[model samples]
Target: MEPRLDLLSTRAGGDLFTMLVSANNALAASPLPRATQELVKIRASQINGCGFCVDMHTKEAAHAGESPVRLNLIAAWREATVFTGAERAALELVEQGTRLADAAGGVTDEAWADAAEHYDEEQLAALVCQIALINAFNRLSVIVKRPAGSYRPGRYA
Candidate 1:
């Protein structure tokens, strides 16, 4: 399918995306586990219905040797047995953070506490930022109807 807007072709879009990608790359320095980071992004993208991001992150996760079982089960993570407790906490944060309007008062204290239990302040900061960033990217992609299935792992890198 043709995109409604070629976000990379226009100078404004290009400039915006460059900054966005840079911000995304900077998160690589965070102490948060790479697997958790990728999982968070994938889950947030899925919640936001951003297929482009889902394709990109799932492939990137696989490229980094993430288990296919974990990748496939993210949507049903609550029922999956492949994730660690910490990973489950992060996934809960992603869902609550991504679907803020679904619940009143945004992310609940319970979810935040759950995440806090697994992550120190530094890692929690990264997780929150990751959630925000992925949601922003998701909105942009969904708004432009970004086509999926063509992304190469690290294409943004």
Candidate 2:
């Protein structure tokens, strides 16, 4: 399938892409565990219905040694046995954050408290940034109808 627009080809898109890449790099260098980052990225992508992102993050996670079992279970994380309490908390945050419109009050205090229990202030900051960044990327890709299955890990590195 062809994309509706080539985001990278336009000047405005090039600027936006640079900023997004910088944000992503900041999150990547944060205190949050790489595994948790991948899981969060995949989960947010899944929730946003961005196939391009889902494909990209899943492949990146696998390349970084994430097991197929865990990758496959992200969509059903609430019922899965393979995740840590911290990972589960992050996933919950991602869901609430991504689907903010569905919940009247946005992310609940309970969810924030749970995440606070698992992560320090700095890590929590990074986690929030990561979730927001992925959601933005998902919207961009989904809106553009970007095709999936061509991403290679480290392509932009």
Candidate 3:
């Protein structure tokens, strides 16, 4: 399959993609754990059905030493035994935040409180930004019908 738009080929699209990449780099410099950040990205990608992102993040996570078991279980994280409390909280936030149109109140207080229990303000900020960023990427990829299974770890880094 081919992408409907080559975002990197056109000047406007390339500029937009560059800005997103820059924002992602800034988020990467935040205090959130790398493993957790990958997991959050994967979960949001799954929710968004962005196969390109799911494939990208899973490979990136594995290259970063994330266990196959944990990566595979991320979609089932609510019942999986492979995550920490903070990771679970962040996952919940991912679900809530990604499915914003499905819920009346958006991210619930309970979920925010749970995330706060496990993360500092700085980490929470990172988590929120990462979730939003991944979702944006997902939407872009999905809208363009970006095909999956061609990504290599660090290709975009």
Candidate 4:
């Protein structure tokens, strides 16, 4: 399938896309663990039903050495025992943040507090950015009806 538009070819779209990619690259350089970053991206994509992003992040995470078991279990993270407490907290935040419209209070204070217990201020900032960025990507892909399962690791990087 084809994207409705080539986001990278149009001048305005390309500029905005490039800026977003640059922001993502900077976030990748943050102190947040690579595993955590991948997990958050995959989880948010799943929640948002952005198949292109799900395909992209899952492949990228695997290339970064994320295990199949953990990758497969991200959608059911609440019931999985493979994640650390910190990872769990982050997942909680991802769920709440991604489903903001479903919840009355946006991200709950409880979820934020839980994440704070596991991450420093810098790491939390990185996590927030990661969540927001993934959501934006998800919306763009879903709205454009981008097809999935053809992404290669590092293709965008």
Off by over 4 Å in 1: none
Write candidate 4's Cα lDDT for 11-105 as tens digits. 98789888889999999999999999999999999999999999999999999999999999999998999999999999999999999999998
> Candidates 1 and 2: which is better by lDDT?
2
lDDT score, candidate 1: 0.93
Winner on TM-score (3 vs 4) = 3
The stretch of ten residues in a row with the least summed lDDT in candidate 2 is 148-157
TM-scores, each model vs. reference:
0.98, 0.98, 0.98, 0.97
Q: Candidate 2's C-alpha lDDT?
A: 0.94
lDDT of 3 by residue, 1-157 (tens): 8889987888987898899899988988899999989999999999999999999999999999999999989999988999999899999999999999998989999999999999999999999999999999999899989899999999888
Residue 32 in model 2: lDDT: 98
| Alpha-carbon runs more than 4 Å astray in model 2 | none
Q: Which prediction has more favorable TM-score, 1 or 4? A: 1
Candidate 3 has which clashing residue pairs, if any? none
Per-residue lDDT, model 4, residue 152, is 94
**Least well predicted 10-residue stretch by lDDT in candidate 3:** 7-16
Displacement of residue 12 (Cα, Å) in model 2 is 0.6
Q: Which stretches of candidate 4 lie over 4 Å from their true place?
A: none
Candidates' C-alpha lDDT = 0.93, 0.94, 0.94, 0.94
